[model samples]
Target: MSKYIPGNQKHLTLVDRIYIENELNRGTTFKDIAKFLCKDPTTISKEVKAHRLSDWYHKGTFYNAKNFCIHRYHCKKTNACGKIILCGVKCTSCPTCNQTCRDFEKERCSRLDKAPYVCNGCPKKINHCTIAHKYSYNARFSNRKYRELLSDSRSGVNLTKHELHKKDRIISPLIEQGQSPYQIVTNHPELELSVRTVYTYLDQGLFTARNVDLKRKVKFKPRKCHKTQISDRTVFINRTYQDFQTLHLESFTEMDTVHSSRDSKKTLLTFFFTKEKLFLAFLMNRCTEGAVRLIFDRLEKRLGTYGFISTFEHILTDRGTEFGDPEALETGANGIQRTSIYYCDPMRSGQKGGLEQAHTMLRMVLPKGTRFEFLTQWDVNLIVNHINSMPRESLGGRTPYSVALETLGEEVLNAFQLRPIAPDEVNLTPKLIRFNS
Candidate 1:
């Protein structure tokens, strides 16, 4: 039993033979074996487990060295299973002779192949027997329907670097600069990007919107008016002077009737001087001759007779009822006696370009459709002063007051002033009653 293996005797290493016998026959504990051999118990255990021979009565008998060595030799030579059956070599037999379980219906290896009844060695049974199951747990069998989506190439098909840069660099900046998405795409068709893609890129933070400070404010849609009902005002001055290049500083005020609300019947008369960039507002019960006259008189009073006569050269107006009697007010107001008046054409509100332009500044305080009833004369005056003090691009960024004083010459403008013209003072009385004959 001890001298069974030739290597152990011919090479009869005292250490190997004694170590094995002490470990197997003497039933030395692993700790003792480790202490005796000065080797790890794990190494010794692995060696014994590998060499041990199995028998029905003796469970993996290693006590008989010769039987153990002989069984090892037979196993190597015969390709035999260690667990033998009562009848023959196999303890469990497959229907197939190739040592593979077969599905008689599919006529294939039942464990490795999908068959009508047999599943991969898994007793729970699955629809398909995957190759990965035999070797590793990570493998899975995906049906064809789901394979295309899970593939690598199609994951980012919808986005690319070019698209990202265009969004960040081109589309976003242009939009920020006041260009719309449609404009961006239309302007550069070769960019190969859609308007929707530009939007998508913006959302993803690939590009930022450009900051645009618009020179002219946005215009809102005007109230619907029947074409036939509009006034037949003259637009010669506006059409003749399309823009500021052809405009003059004389009076040239933009006029509109400010209202209490969209539905308010009460309104105020407003005048925005284009050259001076001044806002002159007065409350008006209606856009009638009386209201217009009162506004003109108030303006003259504040501006002075000389300043009023010099500055009130032209009044640009829309054909609203309040401004319809512009000639009478221009003549009636003592200070504005020398002023001429102009009108915007029928339904062409934009033709009175001067005041229409200044409306942006005026709206800062007295906004469009603002009710005259709610605002006091003092509030209107404050708003007017604020606007007159504001710097305007038309006057080289100078305020209306600054530009007016510069144009009119300070001393002369100050000397020419508004005064209370009493009705008695307005008389044609002989300046000294020289009719003593």
Candidate 2:
């Protein structure tokens, strides 16, 4: 058989070892067996020597000594012995001759030391062979031993108790201080742990901190999205997302409503400016079209005609009941077109993906199921300020408030009641909201 070249490195299978055993029993050379198995000859030689069984027995004992020899080839005095003239090689094989011969010594074949390392392929008959050494490979025993070693290798922790304690001491305080594992590892040069290991340790409860202590590790129920079918009366009929995209509006705002529990009537009206990534929040008594229109009117009144026109030239929003009245949201009280409103396709919130991503930060502060009934507009403003103050990597590490202040100017920000929090003061946790309260 031609040699089989493997394309990738892989572990030896039971079939390979069994093939080696069978070939050995058939008197095949290790070189030929290695060529057929696409392995090194030394690998085959080592395998037979490693797991081969050996046994010893007295003369006339019915013992299979194919691979067993207690003193085989070990003694050096056999050739120099005085009995060499009478006993010759048979003296070493005869068990009853001299229980203790001074010059008695055993010998191993040169073939065993060179290539195969076992007697499996030897042509010498086992019964007539002077050497009692034997080597036999068992596939079942080798495979079992391989599995046991593999399992043992993977069962223990890599870190010692002292090392674990040292890491726990450094990590626990940072976690308690609201620093993420990634942040801690990046900031501390002395900590030689990967972020994944820290998280794993926390998950396994090996540290003082637990998974629940990590804000992002806290699990929440996935938000259920009910697909709403559009009818002729649907506001989306006039201004579809495709129409809005065709206009190629560079600056636009994404609007969405964040509700509390079903038991509460209050909701947060979230607006995200795509260019600056500035997020704004308004607390509302209820999620109604009238309430949304009321906020729009208030914004128009505050920014006046031109400022409102510049700020909200185009608004993209999901097809929610709260934003059902596109006409009311688009038109002013005097019937002037203050802004244009476009609806994303049903169940396609990703069309306005910026606002959805911004909601994730909001979730960190006011998590889902939080009661918004007691929250006031001032509280919403504070949360929005903190969110806008966070440095966004996409914005070149500039805070949204800073970018908005530069792009929209101080007058527009003041009109919207948006203010920048200090870099260190900006917090995106519930604790900040509670502290402010």
Candidate 3:
């Protein structure tokens, strides 16, 4: 049963039909058909293959029902026979459990009878684990238990030998000086300990000193009723006597420095006579004691034997570094001896009232922190001369120069050979210099 090949349907030529039969049924090839029909072998083959029809074929097939009826359906992206029924139970592919019981894969259940209970064959081995199941299990498994065990297992809990030595070495001196914790730590950084440690040492009673202010480098607070602490220096004053009305001019003098803020390099050293209310101001190149000694020497040279013979009773001063050593101020080459020097109590400005008041007047020309490193000696002399010539209220509105002349007398005043003020330069018209005493 061979399949028939079709040639042309419309106006079929006899030769083409004969060629097809001979090529198909008679085992004659298309090359022989091409030679008989005078056509290409490919053209003869295509003509034979196309347009062939069965009595009842779909398009081009013989009437063999068994082979032609077979069918195949294909799907490129999906399976053609998909399952319709879906099982709602938990899947075995789930991480923790298979679909044995209702509970999904979560923490392992502790009950023994349940079929999906954690098994030994489970991958994560989650059986009988309480911490994973209950939030309340946290307290039983805390870090405090571990820490307590660790501490109990250790051998020591105290300072080392080196640490104790370092602590003792630094703390001993601070305690001996009676210094506060704040003071000790600030001054000695190597201590490397808290103020509470010092406080504990104090409570244990370690060390002591005499001057608390010096020990701590700080002053104590005054009581509400009193502004300052009472001093013991007044007892010494009793030994010297309080009868100032009878004392000689040579017994005492008040000393102070005055200068312009613009010209602090040149200071005017003022010495006021306590008994006669006379004043003298000298130009100074520096606030050094050397400069002070030089001025005293000049005064001695001008005043001759009287200046050399006069006793210098006492010098009162503030805590200036220039007067740090009183011996340097008193050491004159010829015949000058010792002079008693007194320091005014801290914060007690009234103790040096005369000098304090003079300083206030000086502040009008030279305010605080003025540098004495810029002025010439002649400039200081002119300013100091003017100040001495100014009238003072303590001397009944008389100029310091005039008061000196009246008290010491013209001859003694003339001994120094100070320049006399001309009539025009001298304003006898009095003006009182008022200041806080």
Clashes of each: 13, 5, 3
Instruction: Assess the local accuracy of residue 180 in candidate 2 as a C-alpha lDDT between 0 and 100.
Output: 95
Off by over 4 Å in 2: 1-234
Candidate 1 lDDT over 1-437, as tens digits, reads: 32442332232134553455444433355556544555555544543443333222222333222231222222322213333344343212222222332211222234333211112134333343212122111111212222443475565437577766654676665665777777889998877878776655554455665223221223344358644222544424343233332565454657676556756666667766666665556667765667777767765676676666666666666555655555566674443375766655566777666666656655655456555555566555545554566555777776676676666566533433312223233322222112211
The weakest ten consecutive residues by lDDT in model 2 span 60-69
lDDT-based ranking: 2, 1, 3
**lDDT for each of the candidates?**
0.49, 0.79, 0.48
What TM-score goes with each of the models? 0.36, 0.48, 0.37
Candidate 3: worst-modelled 10 consecutive residues by lDDT: 68-77
Full ranking by TM-score: 2, 3, 1
Per residue, candidate 3 scores C-alpha lDDT tens digits across 318-387 of: 5444555555565555555545555554555565576666555555444566565644444334443455
Give the CA lDDT, 0 to 100, for residue 29 in model 3: 61
Off by over 4 Å in 1: 1-223, 226-251, 301-307, 333-337, 366-370, 408-437
What's every prediction's RMSD, in angstroms? 35.2, 22.1, 41.8
Residue-level lDDT tens digits of model 2 in 1-437: 12346621456789998998889878788889877888777677767787776543334322333323344334333433354565445333444323456543445667566656666666774555555554557777877887898899997668899988998888999899999999999998687888998888887899999988898778765468664333445577769999898999788999999989979989889999999999998888988889999999999999997789899999999877888778889899778899998989878889999999999999999999999977888888988999998999999999999999889999999988988788888788999778768
**TM-score, predicted candidate 3 vs. hidden true structure:** 0.37
